[model samples]
Target chain A: MPVFGFYKLYLSSDRKYVKKLKNLLGFIPGNLSLYRMAFRHKSIATNVKKGVKNSNERLEFLGDAVLGSVVAEVLFKLYPYKDEGFLTELRSKIVSRVNLNALARKMGFEQLIEYDNRMVSNTRQGSLLGDAFEALIGAVYLDKGYEFTKDFLINHIIKSHIDIHKLEQTETNFKSKLIEWCQRHGKDVSFDLVENQEGESNKLFSVHAIIDGEVMGLGKEFSKKNAEKLSAEKACEALGI
Target chain B: MPVFGFYKLYLSSDRKYVKKLKNLLGFIPGNLSLYRMAFRHKSIATNVKKGVKNSNERLEFLGDAVLGSVVAEVLFKLYPYKDEGFLTELRSKIVSRVNLNALARKMGFEQLIEYDNRMVSNTRQGSLLGDAFEALIGAVYLDKGYEFTKDFLINHIIKSHIDIHKLEQTETNFKSKLIEWCQRHGKDVSFDLVENQEGESNKLFSVHAIIDGEVMGLGKEFSKKNAEKLSAEKACEALGI
Candidate 1:
């Protein structure tokens, strides 16, 4: 703590909230209202002006962009030889809602989110936490500024919580990942066996990832499962998931 | 020009390119190769290493994120009373490919972009200009850092070229815009006139914007054209375009 931090914390009305935020983010917030608003879900928010609520939705939009830019920069520098398709996929893996929800849960975001449980479903509640996580980044960006938010995201969040190296090495679940991506985007994905060539080995299997009724990717391998996996991987690359 | 800039320009092999870039962007680039890569279309690029080439795609991806973040921040502050949906729509309008293409043309991006005309059709060439615009932003970002790039975007680009207030007030021709958006996404969008209400205004019409066979937005207005426009606008809002 700074020399005057304890004195200010003792007198502040929302000292507990400030302390918790400080403890979590490793920085004192400039605008406390932004931080509060970051956790205030639409379920509990009152309309502020012109039908715009003092909810975290706006913050989520801003934070999403901020997070995307930071992640893009990180991936761009980390993988100097990789193409945009690879960088985009790795960034998506890092910022996907499922990954974010897990990160939020691990970071105790549950304590800060202010959504009405009755209005939000049990399944939707997890997203509320992820929403708040993005909103928190928005709050930090607005409160401190872009450079500060970048530092916080890099030093405090990405460096400590994320493993970019490990993420790159783990390419085993492309089929499931592609399916989940399709589900999230309200699209349908299916793997279909393509007809084998007349002269090809009988043991070799051919598969295609049919997403939204279009063949997004094709793969041929010895095993059916491997073919499916390879096709899904190719689909992910094509879809930039 | 700054001190020694004229001297350096005299000795530089690509002094004309440097001068052209400076004239367009209102700043001298620090890293010249990054700027060169920004304009190098994949159609003209040779292999650099692995599958990656000296193309603009990676930089475009990075610049896309950077531009989104900068635009998000700008809109967030500009429209304090607006919802995220509104901000998102406005941001898309500014960053849309059509807008960027027009902007790039106005700024003489055609002269800078290096592409094989035989390989790229006339229709495809416009998007290449837009891609180079984005990649140029990425070059600026990499050369001058985020703060400097942000300042360049805001001061040199957005402030001088864009009219936010005018864009907000001018909400005409949304139907065509929506159709263009759908075409860009390879989705089908149709405006169907639903049944008119009995005993309502004689000219009243009801329309729904059906996207991918799903009713995304509905609107009721005095005229069929107005109804279609309103529905399209609502669909744009719904799609966050």
Candidate 2:
């Protein structure tokens, strides 16, 4: 009863967070502290008690899992015939850091985050918005439960941002595709690193894709892998095999 | 009405599977077909329509995510004081391929799996059992929903096998620990590969841990990382810092 009383008092005290959450989630939170904690980044974490972390890290972890599960479920249903690999790739596309950062910006998630770190003001630096986005899911799961979290994601996020058709058309790795095509056609393919030069903080690499002892495509990029991919894409188009 | 009629007819046809599931899951499945799909491994998968894969792989992916979310929630509540890294490490230990394989055997999960692959008979050959274990969790989530799935995992699995204290004592990586300890004590430590010899199909790597420019400990293993870990353990014991 005492705990319940405290929770009630806590909920009543935070009308601002409650209003924000209601606008974002379209539901009143059962426990307000969980949502507040979700917004609280580790940079501003105070009162470091012994072994406990008084920040959003744990919640972010939990939210990441929850978000994955919900997305997997939706994808499982949406693409009933798609193989595991396709499902996985699509899920990754949906939850990719770049996509999440853009989604967070579109949803005004940065405005709600409680971070004291100066580095995070840049917005595009690492997984700031994405982490907060996931932490928000965790808070929703804690406040309302799994079904509600799934519903919140579906109604609020997935229907708006995730375009399944567009993602399928988007090329992920041309090198892998080219290799698979070669294997299926019984053709030998190899990628040779043609050049490597020092860049600002990385190495600029040039690669050439050789198909059946012929240099079919050439590419230059910051990483050897990317260069190979670009070369493979060119090779895939030029060879048309 | 037609779909409901077909569902009832389908449920009636699989009395044996239903009975077996009740014995295993402690509840009658709302949808037995999902559980049936959970056991359907890719090797024996039939009716491979265009984009559809009639195997447990997709279910396995979904189940893995669901299982992780539930486990994360449990760990979060159980270890209220533990940090995110600690929680992630413990979760990895619990859901690791080896541990999952062992748990699957303990729960007789392999007995029900439908795999036509010759390699799976080895039991410890790879992640076969663990994959099935995850697929089973996915089936449970689909059939009984998240709440029931969580209860099943907590009541049937975690309560029986997952000992938090024992896990905390489990040495994950001696090398990482030694490096951390060295850093804390302001001492320089490095692990170098001292030798490489040909073994069955791989090279046996010998590594030595050098502390303050002195060879403190030596180790040999199949992998450089493992060899480093072994050497680090020895160095930790020898230095006793």
Candidate 3:
């Protein structure tokens, strides 16, 4: 670093904080307070005015949109011929709370986030990192600009960490999702082998996904497992679950 | 337009369309095909390939994200001290299907949209204009880029049209509005007091809006009246009332 720049960094009381953020985000935040507010959980934030607190919630809202737009643009270019349904589904998978929570963990966001440990439960604690990850994006957006933020998200976040093709595989895992959905709705669901077409190597297995004694979907595939999965996918589509 | 630009417009096969778009949007389109696709509804669209149609749906999806990001930034700046919930509510009002439909009608979008009149119902027909409006934004984003689109949205769509303060005024008396909606739908509605957080102030009132025996919204405030109003507003927003 230049002598003057280092001197400025050295003289600041928040030198450690700025350095830590720079090390983590690969950019020195221009407005330090934005970054500070991004990591602060509401539990530890005192009421500022008009029932508003200096919490990361507002930043999360902003960052969510920024991240979504970036991801949407990337997917739109990457899958030019794909339909809206495909784009929407892929976008949701990439931005789901569960997926983001995992990303935050992998990116070491837990080290930066400030939350009251006693107030937040174990499950709620998991979301704190995800919220902070989004808030960080918001901070970057404000400190820089939309173009810079887009570049940062595309180069630093999406290209560096996410495996899009691998993530797409999760889209086809309909059977487990169907089971989970059924469990949530308190409905009994079952997949039963309906028939087999042909007898030799060209044989196709048929399965039916039934819920509450009614057949929700029927599918035919080369293997029993795949037939069940396809049936479950059809059922999921029918139920919009 | 300059003489050369006029010559290009006059000689083009879609001169009328190009002229109409230029008049309506206040700028000439760089990519005419994108604008055409933006107004093409799915009911009239031929399947391109693999269940994909050259309709406005994909563009609408892209535009939704772009519009959301722009609005979020605007709200973030305009209401620096506002909470996420307030920002979210205001943003939704600005981008709601009902609002967009009205805007489209006022801005002469109905003539541009191409839908199979026989296929779309009355309510669906109303939203078609809104869909096209978003798709048009998507076209602008793709053709002129994000900065241009943002400028266009702020200057032409938002500032020239919407009254933000007036909209905020309309957000009042949501409790009465929610009750009216419930009554019209023949559903039972009530505001119930939920337990205040254990560590929170004793004066805090947490209210839940219950509709048809299901919890629809929760809101916290210092007074029960405000809490109930907030809860009802949340429920109304949730129901898209």
Candidate 4:
């Protein structure tokens, strides 16, 4: 296809293009400009003068929160008996990078992204897919409203991807359970730092659990508390306390 | 006060208690059980043999997500330009342990707790405070609905506690900007593992970013990707490309 022909066929905001996109999204009468901006990648440089922002970064920001709120509200209504910790874990899992990327790919967003030659060759598909998915949400919200966005999310995202039964069964209070066990058995549990190695990328903390003056278990984590918990769990298992 | 006198003073479901709680919460009653369940701690061994579940954990779960969604919606409306990372960080700070505990304490929940002698003396204060705060939210939701909860959260939580201006000034996108800079300058940038340590608490990864085969920067984190981003950021600063 000719370069101009590609623009005519793919980038036109005519009835055909709008109709096709509407059919794909399962919604109609959306703002075409917003949808256009949603699909526009940063690599496709705008011809505007300096100081004019070109990318959909701003829209992505709005979209991310919209997505989060919609998903949270749905989960809240669906699982009245589930706790805050479980709801948070479920939300995180649903909105994770891998899940977003999978959704973007499923929607065939690559065909819509307007990237230049250089960016097209890059292997960083993960970031692109994530960005596109967020942008699409922004578009949906702008075209409709909160109610429409909520409906779309419920129908397209939650109902399609998440397993409600599995989410209900996920364990959350391991740390609390461990503490309760220690209290019941009259065992003194303490976590001590074994090492702190600072490197170029991130800080690492190593911790060991001391039970009865013996190093019963060890763990490593990005945060000190997480490491301590891991070590404490190991110690609990080892001592059978 | 005598034990019988104290029981008479404290245990009566007087109009004063109802009026005082209603005034404090700014919510009218219909779902009194939901409110009651919100305040009832699991430690208080209620008559479960008759099938009355004694704890507010389930309510806490519902309230937590409701609080999060409401807060998120308020932030989204207030901060139009803020990104996902910024919003997440701000939400975390707002709903942090210290903040929630302070809120609970301010509401005079410490005196309202009905824990037994054993659990009361223990350091379960943190959990108690957190649960009470969540219960208060559950009460508000039941007394009102989603609209009331949203308004209450905005007025009581966000406006009272969070510093919106400070959050607006925080910067992000360092990693993506660095990549764009490298590509523009026709330089190859790659992150290599410089150190790997496994300790008792968590696994740590240190990474170094090499630009055009020269070590430009180093970074460390619990996760390799995060550490690699830090290394890339350092390289961006060192090279000034």
Candidate 5:
């Protein structure tokens, strides 16, 4: 009877912890176990049962992608006129590792993290904070639906930190700007594949944007166009036309 | 009044197009010019208006991130028990360039694209399809809220094409499986960093899994762990232990 009472008390404590988390997040709890596992760093060496996996690294990975998506979705909705570059810059700013780490610190997640004493130095703390931020995101997505995740991000991250107007203007059309500068002063622009090499892992392409038979820029990247764009930008700077 | 009549017809056609797009996507049209600009390709040379930008590339960039988020969200909900690796693989499968192109093709986006005849071949078609897919996604986000985008993806992409169970089992946690197998079979598993190179573009690492003082497998990747995992898979196959 005493053992049964102890078990009942343990269950109540678990419920209370989950309730506390829900209050902190401003959302209902769906899978508190997942959230707990998510906060458990591998360094802690906790006993994982037969069916369970270890650490929140997996959750962090999932959360990273989820956070990226939710942020992108919000950016899309908020800036209807913004082009891809603008949206990307904004999303990057919002979900940058530094920003995520800051948010994690704000959430008091460092206190909850279960890391080894040896890894408690200043440098490790930052990385752990970043990882915990990602884990929290994973936990959030698991606890609530995507809508809630989006709303949470919008309220917590974007609304508080990001300057939407500045992002919109700065991230606007680089390619167009380059092209316009070229055309306004009567110059022809073309991207030529200078060298294309297939590496052991990824294919690499070196591109040069030839303007009036002069190589304006030279760049290399995994994709031809991306490399070409980099080269084009360099060329734009070089020519000053 | 012929010019006025022409303007009236143009407005009506625009309205009809917007209405059809809204019906398909579920978000009310936010900016007609932005939408129109989103459908434009760089190949379609036109007079540069003062404030107007060319091509859907920027929108495509924004859409790419948005699509990634939406797909991530869908996968998260669909596979609650699945780990991060499983979620990533599924998301990648859904949002990969190949998959996006297929979806774009299904939507009959080729007809809607405003590209030059030179860029309409089979090879260039994939990029076009991919871009259209992104633009469509951007359009959908604008036309519908985040919920609608999530629902559309679930209905159109996940339910229709993706095999959730297969994705969940095959793609993620390969490293974990390897570790478990080693533990069960009483074999020591260790990832030895053979080479770590920080290149200008990417950080490259080579890893070898030394099982019983023998190089069981060796692989190279942008990431050390990823390289180690690849090596581990090879080791598993070679040793047959």
Candidate 6:
């Protein structure tokens, strides 16, 4: 009972944690346990009993939903007459895994999060940071509610970090466009994985977008679809379609 | 501006809408315009010059996010010890197109929703119902805020209609399990569209789950994936894996 009571007090009274969170979140957290859970990765969580849950996973799930809601609302408001598909595509571009990961890293969440050293490396850090960023939103929602969370996302995340204009200009999926173009022109298009080289830990795939028995575009990436997409972008530029 | 002013008064005073909504939601909505928009399908919308927006699509998008948030929160609280993946899979099952469509239809939302009669048929009704359901939830959120929306979902939607226990027991993705089972058993698994018969308006797909060049399961549906899934489910039962 004393240990449980002491833990609660420690969560509220931790000066270093308060300062760190204040710096990270730009405000003092009302409930410290939520924030602590936000930063606590499952890899380093101490197992107490079978039914006991520990880690940011649940919070991450909650935050992801809240974040999606806020983002969808902002997009809906911003693009008044835009169709649902347009809004969905734009939102996807902004909240893409790579985009979120980069944004989280830029916000210094990677440094603030706690995880097992053995579980994390440079290769897997991107996803970790993105998950932590979502978990933070979950914590913020729990501590301050939807309006406060929405304000934070609007002022802090979307406004400061995300460039909607630039993102709009950047075509998120070129391959789909290229395929559509080819279909309209009565041309058959196909992608072939020409090369797959093993990296230190992962395989790199090289693909060629072939059209009418000609290699129209060539691309190389860590994944086959991406490599094909890169080649398709090149093909699109070449064909001006 | 008198017309606009009068419209606002009419929305609040509309006895039929209020009564219907009260019966549906257990409370009167504050913002009737949001609810009106929620039921206002794009096909039935009257044109009011350029740049003016109409229809429930935007609200549907918003409601989708809000619904997702509520569902995630419910799942998170209910399954405290479940991993993120498990929670995600469960949430997906609940919010899935088939599930939502069935739930919406069962709630008699199709009869209440405003849509163009020319644009809808039995074949295209599932998505319409699902979208309307999401839009209704969106309207509820806008009218009553998060707590009220959460309450409506918990009390009205999940409590009365949804059987979480039954849904938990149901394996939503039998195909994935069957594939994994086949892989473990060193059997090649493939789904072949053996029959595709054209109906009056739609095509019916008949798929067979082929295991080691043997037809292990047979299924028929309007869609290929669903047919394959039905077959996969049969396959799972037959193999007892």
TM-score of each: 0.73, 0.71, 0.72, 0.56, 0.58, 0.71
Tell me the native contact fraction for each prediction: 0.65, 0.71, 0.58, 0.20, 0.43, 0.57
Better of 2 and 6 by TM-score: 6
Candidate 6 residue lDDT tens string, B49-99: 464457888788889999999899899889878777888888987987667
| Model 6 regions more than 4 Å off | A1-13, A48-53, A173-227, A230-241, B1-13, B47-53, B173-190, B193-241
lDDT of 6 at A2: 58
Top model by TM-score, which number? 1
DockQ of predicted candidate 4: 0.11
DockQ of each: 0.29, 0.32, 0.25, 0.11, 0.19, 0.30
Q: What tier of docking accuracy does candidate 1 attain?
A: acceptable
Which lDDT values do the candidates have, in the order given?
Answer: 0.85, 0.78, 0.85, 0.66, 0.67, 0.80
For residues A184-240, what per-residue lDDT tens digits would candidate 5 score against the true structure?
758787777754322222476777777766666777788877887788767755653
Give residue A128's error in model 1 in angstroms. Answer: 0.7
TM-score for chain B considered on its own, for each of the candidates:
0.70, 0.68, 0.71, 0.61, 0.57, 0.68
Winner on TM-score (2 vs 3): 3
Flag regions of model 1 displaced more than 4 Å: A1-12, A169-241, B1-10, B169-241
Ranked by TM-score, the better of candidates 2 and 5 is: 2
Off by over 4 Å in 5: A1-31, A45-54, A73-82, A118-122, A161-241, B1-38, B45-54, B77-82, B118-122, B162-241
**How much is the lDDT of residue B45 in candidate 2?**
76
- Give the alpha carbon lDDT tens digit for every residue of A75-168 in model 2: 9888888888988988987887657767877788777888877745442344677778888888899878999899989988888877867987
Better of 4 and 6 by DockQ: 6
Task: State the lDDT at B216 in candidate 2.
Answer: 75
Positional deviation of A29 in candidate 6, in angstroms? 1.1
Q: List the residue pairs that clash in candidate 5.
A: A69-B69, A84-B58, A216-A235, B27-B143, B27-B144
Model 6 per-residue lDDT tens digits across residues A102-209: 898898887678888788764465578888888999999988988899999999889999999899889767899789878877889988876332121247676778
Residue-by-residue lDDT tens digits, candidate 1, A1-241: 3546556556657788788988887887866788999999999999878688999999999999999998999888888889999998899889987678888888888888898889986647777878899999999988888889888999988898888888777765889989998888789889998775433468889888988887787788999999999999899778645
